[model samples]
Target: MLPFFTNPYPDELLYSAIARYHFYSGNLDCKDTLEELFGSRSVIPSVEIGSNFTILAEKLGHQYSVESLLTNHTIYPYYASFLSKQRQQEILENVKGDGQGLYTRLGIVAGGICRKDGLYYCSTCAKADAECYGEPYIHREHQLQGIDYCSHHEIPLRKYPKTNDSRIEYIRFELKHMDLSPLYEIDSHKELAIHLAKQAYKLLNLPLHYLSREQINSKYRTLLREYNLITSSNRVRQQEMYQAIKSTLPNSFLQRYESAVNNNDEYNWLRILTRNLKRHVHPFRHLLFLYFLQYSVEKLVDIDEDDGAFGRGPFSCLNKAAAHYKKFIISNVIVTRDFKTKNLIGTFTCSCGFIYSRKHTTDMFEIGRIKAFGDVWLEKLHDLQQQNLSIRAIARELGVDFKTVKRYLIGNVEIKQVKSHRDNDDILGIYKQDLLKEIKKHPNLSRTALRNKYKKQYMYLYRYDKVWLDEALPERRYGQNTIKKVNWAKRDQQYVQEINRLHQKLLQSEKPIRITISKIGKSLGTLANLEQHLNKLPKTNKLLNDIVESVKDFQLRRCYKIIDDLLENDQEIFLWQIQRKAAIKSHHFHAIQPMLESYIEMKQEVTNNERTTS
Candidate 1:
């Protein structure tokens, strides 16, 4: 068995511990140390080194498994919670079998790499480690990309340079052996840097389970709804949410992490987060969203099915006389009904026998209606009443309505009666006789005109006095002296004569114009009338149909005319020039290409024979 170090630091990574072991054991070569520990020499170490936990545990003679080492030291815990169950198991198997090769499979590289140039180490942490443990090592938290400062110390980390060649397999974290760069203070965005660092630190050290995609999506939607970043029907307010997220995170931080979505891109990551997540998102993205929403990892990971639904409850108990008075244990829920009207009811009940309900379509409650005030509130009201305080005054003192004070004085605890439509009908009855007299005075007037003239009376009568109003008002008559009948046969003959005249006039023109239905109808100024009587105007229809040409035929005719013009001018005929002059598109020329080719061949042969005879 290989001798390994005991008492590793709380934040020490597995790679750092192994590197320390290599140092303490006087091993000079990293490749040799890896070969001895993992029983393989094909391993390549990256900044985010992983997958050697089981091998290390076995070699160190420890009883703990790979899961323990990963949860305590690596950043896998943060990413694992956002991955699927199958993915989490796959990650564990890969880590136990292969060292430093699971980042791609785990989707950590999906957002592109944002790590610093080389190895990072906090000067304060290194000094503390050397003073306490006799040596300093690389911290896994500081090694994470986009984390500029140490989470604990809130100080900028220093970088260590390395060769660009891949020949260097693994570097041991020795403060004296490495060339450490000078540290610089973070001039701007110090608070943002520190906050992100602390969150990353928490993620690295905390032990969390894989949160289902559904769970994460639910948590995000809940936050969006709370912020009014989504519509009631669950469509995301993309523009608003995008602006809010952009304003919340610094531009430099977003650019560094590659999380900045452009304003014009419709299918950005923020939109995808609100939609059904079809694939696993990177952990950094999840952390970025959590940070923007002002939520910690603990809160996000602890979200349950009961949470982010209906209302965030442990609502205050209104029953003051009960043992749990004023305690937040009551639950306000929305009870849905199948009917359209009165479909929802908000119910609030305490375990102490006090119940209050309000009919509302939403789940929100009226705080003043929580009548759970116990005997103490009643006693105060009673004292005030005895001291000659008015109902309004007593209600103002107790922070309740005058009706509530009156109810308490009357010793009645029943719920107040809700107003119904019948009351409105009584109010409308006052104007019933006047409306009837007006309708009788103008019997020929249309119902719509009368209703508009007396809108309120008509609406009330339409709702409550349907039978009487229908009988009193005249019938809604259509086609009353408005529409006139026409002899279609005579009109058809007139249209045919007009079309023929227009066509003859076009034929006599200096430039022949195409005879079309629109042209004929427009000349006669009866386009609408001709269209309306088209079925009866068979002669006109037949004449127009005979003149219509297919697109290919029209293009061929135009090309022939161009060729005739070119021949008469004794100009050299070019196919491209002919097509351009004819205004024929490429597809049209292709359709009548055989005729064009034959004409070109005939013209070429005649020219060749003339040259021979000459």
Candidate 2:
């Protein structure tokens, strides 16, 4: 091996260390340093991720390896963490050799988000480096695409002027060329910029293949569901989600990175990021989206093993007739969709063979419909029937309807008839003839009216010759003339109780669903009635007026939910974070701005008081 090379500094780019070698080795050209380090003068230097590390490792002796250089000295880990295992291996191999197609494979060449045109450095970091090590080196974190601020300093980074020969030359940081002045004044966007920087830095330091593409996708889908960006039908609410992300970051900040969302463009970077996990997205876009989701690198990688619409199984059986009722013995769940509602429906099958289905939600336990009662239930029904129990009593015992009991036990039951002279053929024929004559006389009247007009003849034929009576009567016409009066007071009382129960349920739900009159009415299957006859149901009307939420009210509830989430995690409360999580538009947040601030202040006081007392 040649004379000792310049050692890499903490988080220094491999390129930066090599450029320092060129300066220290008295090399007149970068190619000379390349030849000495890589044993090949034609190996091109990449700013972010350098190539041909295998040769450089050999020239540098046993002190370094290709894998070590790639993982430690270069920015490969940040991008590799989001790639598949096979792709990570492919990129590692490429970095070890000539690195042909490396940028293409990493999706950087055409990654939409533009990389910095020249080397970037933080003034504070550079000054500190100069004092500590007698020189400053290019930091890998500073050179990342879409990272505008220094993660450590939380200040805007300055860019070094590029030379005309940048394509062939490796630029080293020089104290003389450093512009230590601030690049831009701190504004409202600075906080967001710093967030991106910090998250990007964390990703840069992550271990290779820390997360796979599938894991990231799963994590995203789960979070999307939590944020209400995905429907119960497993469909991504793309437009609403897009607007939420768009509002999270300032337009100028996104524009600077060439990552601005185009509303009309169907194939924008954000859409592509969520749509296709196999297609590589630049780490910049990935980090940006993670910010929109209120996630850090650690949180995004902490994926749930089962993040399906219906979460992990060993689901509970809802069969009331079985021995394992409400027990978590079911390991099988067949997920399908409701053809009419397009909502996800999960069918649970137990070992006892009882089957049932319901609409899928995180905490839903009620069965929508039963597909089969299985053999155990049928045997139970037979045993119950052996006691000569009435159909209603059997239904109550077996957890079914009286009609269901009758349908199942009809063939086994014996019907007894009393002997009567009305059953005679001549008498039945006379009753049928009289019913047919009455029906012909009242052709315009309904069957009920005809029956009322000829009550004696109808009753005689109804008991003795019901089938003949039905055939002789005309088809009943259901018109306004046949309408009956309804008891409005009874209907009102029934609806009020149902609405009250639903209101209580909404209050206990973990996720906030906006309460409106329409939502409450539709959920209780009384929308049409509530819409037209709400005034008639005075109690329901009053309860609705008191519970239905306005736009601002719903937004405030969301803010409170977000606050509770932060407190549960022991995270500090921040207005920007609350706003982002709540997904409230800026103008709308203004409406509840004072209340949010007051609530936060109150919570802080309580927390502080508790700490003081302890």
Candidate 3:
């Protein structure tokens, strides 16, 4: 084994420790360090989550294991807490191995939250680190993807310079890269940023798989109901929720982290967070939503699923026969929605076996119906009958009507004559006659029209005489049925033609718009068809796969267009001027800066050569 290794500082990344190891070990090449630690020089050191930890644990001796390093050193727990237990286990196994599909599994690559291009460190933390350890090192908390400030000091984090070959090199904090000066100029929305940073830090410290996606969704629904953002119909007021969240977060802060809410975009993170639970959402977006709800991460997880629609339980039992009447002893409540009215219906069950339902059309609790009076009420009725009380008196005692008391007494008769089956046939015959008469009067009426006109007769006949009802109704004509097989081949050709025209139009437009399949499909009014059935449209599918552009490409196109306009007007060009005209965000522009500079230089050279020739 090697001579010794540096113990990781609190919240220090395992990758950062390895970089420190490389320095102190005096290895001439990083490959030698990698070989010594992992027994494989080909291992790629990742900033957020490194691979081959099982081997590294062996090299680190007894003090470090794969689990300990993964828990305290890496940022895996932040994502793990929101993922399924099964998925967390799979990710843990991946971390133990070469960590293939690790980031993709964690949803980092597709999470839509932009990660920092390089390492980040708070300047104050760096100074303190240097003083304490005689050298500064990267902290895991500072490197979180969307967190801008240090939670401890509440100061903005400065990004460290990235190595030329990050795939092969592990960067440790260096004094040359450190700046000790305090930043007096504060960013806008400092309070919101600090809150988000603090929440993110809490998530980083949470245990593995602390909360499942279902639990998170339940908590959000509870809060949304309390905020009165849920409609009476049980649907989330998505537009209002989006507006509220937008108002809480400044647009600049959102744009900086690439978490901006677009009202027109139906699949935005806020909408998805409210509805879909299967998809793994980034923890940073979760923090934004929590901030909107004004809940800390700890409190949010602790909030139980006491859906506010029915309010918290220990609801009053409506059983009048029992001594516990109107007392809050009924702890079990089952909430469901009315199919026809879309109103929430709460079914409260008592331990005494009485069950009653109430529809939450309003705050008042009016009994919609009593499902079961149970044995307690039944025994109470028998006792009142033994006292020889009148039907009305017993009804008053039992909290039921006289007709209900009489019906129950008659229903309890031990030896009653059974009614003949033909007694029900007589009722069915009356309904059947009415249906035939209606059909005879309106010969041209289809089944639907007939059903609507004579709904009661239609329903009675439908339930009891379904065979006869089907025979009596008009036969379904061609193309009347709902399920019609599509001629996919012909439709595919038509869509391909329409999409090709739209694609050309998009390309030739003066404004630089990102070429995405969704954009093309939405323009064609076939977004759903394209998204779900594109594989069947082979030509369209291939074309979309080839033509779609990344956001960076679209930014480049906008930048080049601005440069061309400047050249055409014979105006002097500058990087800041190009960026302002392009309207691309600063951080995003930084990615394409080198290419933009080269393009401007090339254009200048062409102009100079033309002037010389002239």
Q: What lDDT, from 0 to 1, does candidate 2 have?
A: 0.80
Top of the candidates by lDDT:
3
Write down the TM-score for model 1: 0.52
Q: Give me the candidate number with maximum TM-score.
A: 3
Q: Please list the C-alpha lDDT of all candidates, in the order they appear.
A: 0.68, 0.80, 0.83
How accurate locally is residue 420 in candidate 3, as Cα lDDT from 0 to 100?
46
lDDT: which is higher, 1 or 3? Answer: 3
Candidate 2: residue 80 lDDT (0-100)? 79
Instruction: Extract clashing residue pairs from model 1.
Output: 81-211, 314-328, 318-372, 319-372, 320-374, 321-374
Question: Where does candidate 2 stray beyond 4 Å?
Answer: 162-167, 181-186, 312-345, 349-353, 357-375, 381-614
Q: Candidate 3 residues 81-124, lDDT tens each?
A: 67766788888899899999998788886674766788888999
Q: Candidate 1, residues 427-538: lDDT per residue as tens digits?
A: 6667677687887888788988988888888887888878888887878877777778788777777777777777667756643355566667787898786667677777
Q: How far is candidate 1 from the true structure (C-alpha RMSD, Å)?
A: 16.4
**Cand. 3 TM to true fold:** 0.63
Q: Candidates 2 and 3: which is better by TM-score?
A: 3
